[model samples]
Structures are given as structure tokens and as C-alpha cells.
Target: MRVGIADTTFSRVNMGAIAVDELRKHASVAIERVTVPGIKDLPVACKKLIEERRCDIVMALGMPGGKDKDKICAHEASTGLIQCQLMTNTHIIEVFVHEDEAKDDRELAWLMEQRTREHAVNAVKLVLHPKDLERQAGTGQRQGFEDAGPARR
Candidate 1:
């Protein structure tokens, strides 16, 4: 199966590289990469991969700036990704990291790698083994950080 990886040039770390690395661990899965200038462009890139390249699923990766306007754009981009998924009838795992998510560059890099890898796994399962994810439903699983779990009763 073909899995598309759509990342942005605005990212500080090479999230696409990490995702490709993690995805290569699995067998019989092909990866297609499309790098855009910013987050807002991801939806179209992902759609292209889905419709043109015939990807079974896609991972839309982006690093939005911490500014208010950037956050708004990220939300809009996320909505576009959702719409793209519905239109293509395929899964597009949206992996977005805000620039201010961590305190330092080192931590931020780690978070980006962690998040990308986690979502990479999700993308694989989404097509190859969706039942795997279904088994973990409602578990509060998180990417790039510790799992929150369900709020304590």
C-alpha cells in the first residue's frame, strides 16, 4: 500500500525524515512525500497524493508558529484536511506541532520527532491494521508526550 507523507518547509526539525524512518520499519508499505511551504498547503498536497498518487492513507505534518494568527491558520488547515479525508474516503492523519509546545530547541526537536513517529505508526495501522488502533480506543493515547489517560473518576 502507498502511504503519503505531506510535511511543511516551515518546520524546524525534519519531521518527514523521522516519519519515513519509522514507516520503513514495516514491510510492503510504500511512502510518497510532498513538501510544501507551509501548513495551509497540506490539504491540497495530501489530496494530490490520495487521488493522483493513489495513497491508501496520508500523514499531514506541519509546525505552525505560536502566534495567534498561526494558530487560526492551523485550525483552518486541520479543517481542510478533514474535508479532504471525507472527500477522498481515506485517512489523513494530521500531525501538527506548535513552535511553542516546548521550552527549548532541544525539547522541541524531541517532541517533533516523537510526534512524527507516533503518527507514522498510526498511518500504518490505519491502512494495514486498523483493528490495532480500534483496540486502543478511549485510552487517551498521546503523541510527542505522555498519555493523559482518561480523566480520573
Candidate 2:
């Protein structure tokens, strides 16, 4: 299977590369990588990777800025990604880390690394062992963080 990695160049973090490395450790698959200018470009990159590069799955990685406009752009990018997925009938795993999601830069960086790596594994599972994920459904497993079990009164 071929896994495509589409990442934004707007941020300094190298989450996409980390993801690819982690994926290599877990699954033996060919990788196609593309770096775009910003989050908005991820959808097009992913589409090209799928339609032209023949990737079975595309992992879209980006870190949005800490601003309302940035959030809006992220939303638009996400919508476009969904459209691309439908058009190609392929899975586009979105791994977005907003600058404001964490309390500080250090925390955000950690989250980005964790999320990206986890999503890469997820992409592999989606292609090769979907049943494994299906069995974990409702188990409250957050890819980057510890699982939060159901609350009981």
C-alpha cells in the first residue's frame, strides 16, 4: 500500500516527517510526500497524491495559527479535504494542531508530534487492519492523549 503525506510549510514544526517516520516503524508501505504553502493547499496536494501518485491513503498535516482567521482557514481546508476524499473514494486522515489548542509552545509542540504519529498509524490501520480500529471503537482512545473513560454518576 502507498501512503501519501501532505504537510503545510507555514509552520516550523515537522509533524509530517515525524508521522512518516512513525508509519515506517509500524507498517511497510510506500510513501509519497508533498509539502504545500499552507493549510489551504493541503487538499489539492492530497488530491494530486491520490489521483496521480496512486496512494491508497493520504495523511494531511498542518498547524493552524492562533487566530480567528486561521481557524476559519483551517475549517475551509478541512471541508476541501472531505470533498477530495469523496471524489477519490479514498481516506484522507486530517491531523491538525491549532496553535491555541495547548497552553504553551512546548505543549503544542508535543501535541503536534504525538497527534501526527498516531494519525500515521491510523492511516496504516485504515488500509491494512481496519478491524483493529473497529474493535477499539467506543473505548475512548484519544490518539495523542490518554483515554478518558465514560463518566458514571
Candidate 3:
């Protein structure tokens, strides 16, 4: 199986590289990498990886700045990614880290690394062992965030 990794150059973080390393450790799959200029370019990059590179799955990683405009652009890019998935009939796992999600630059960087690596494993599971993901259904575990289960009274 082959996994495509698409990352943006807008941010300084090396999320794509971290994800590639994580995927290599977890699964025995080939990787195709594409680096675009910003989040707005992720959809096209992912599409190309799937259509031309023939990757089984694509991981789109990016860090949107902490601003309203940045959030809007991220939303648009996410919509485009969803459409690409439908068109190609393939999975494009989006792993976005917003600058505002954390308290400071150091925290944001840490979150980006953690989220990227986790999503890489998720991508591998999607391709090789989908049942592993299904087993967590209804557990209230959201990606990139702490699990939310029933609250004890």
C-alpha cells in the first residue's frame, strides 16, 4: 500500500516529516510526499497524489494561523478536501493544527507534532486494519482531542 503525505509551507513546523517518520514506524507502506505553499493548496495536492500518484490514502497536514481570515481559509480548504475524497473515492485524512489551539508557540508546536503523528497512524489503520478504527466507534473519542466519555455524576 502507498500513503500520500501533503503538507503546507506557510508554517515553520515540520509536521509532514514527523508524520512520515511515524507512518514508517507503524506500517510497511510506501510514501509519496507533496509540499504546497499553504492550506489553500492542500486539496489539489491531495487530489494529485491520489489521481496521479495512485496513493491508497492521503494525509494533508497544515497549520493555519491564528486569525479569522486564516480560519476561513482553512474551512474552504477542508471543504475542497472533502469534495476531492468523494471524487476520487479515497480517504484524505486532514490533520490541521491551528495556531490558536494552544497557549503559546511552544505548546502549539507540541500539539502539531502530536496530532500529526497520531493521524499518520490513523491513516495506516485506514488502509491496513480498518477494523481497529471501527472498534472504537461509540466510545466518544475524537481525533486530536481528549476523549469525551460519559461524565460521572
- Please name the candidate that would achieve the greatest lDDT relative to the true structure: 1
What is the per-residue lDDT of model 1 for residues 1-153, given as tens digits with 9 covering 90 to 100? Answer: 998999999999888888999999864688899999999999999999999999999999999999999999999999999999999999999999999899999999999999999999888887788899999898899998999887677
Could you tell me which 10 consecutive residues in candidate 3 have the lowest summed lDDT?
A: 142-151
Q: How many pairs of residues collide in each model?
A: 0, 0, 0
Residue 108 accuracy (lDDT) in model 2: 87
| Residue-level lDDT tens digits of model 2 in 30-127 | 99999999999999999999999999999999999999999999999999999999999999999998898889988888999998988898888889
CA lDDT, every prediction?
0.92, 0.91, 0.91
Q: After superposition, how far is residue 44 of candidate 3 from its true place, in Å?
A: 0.5
The alpha-carbon deviation from the true structure for residue 58 of candidate 2, after best TM-score superposition, in angstroms, is: 0.5
Model 2 reaches what TM-score against the true structure? Answer: 0.96
Off by over 4 Å in 2: 151-153
TM-score of each: 0.96, 0.96, 0.95
Alpha-carbon RMSD, each predicted model: 1.0, 1.2, 1.5
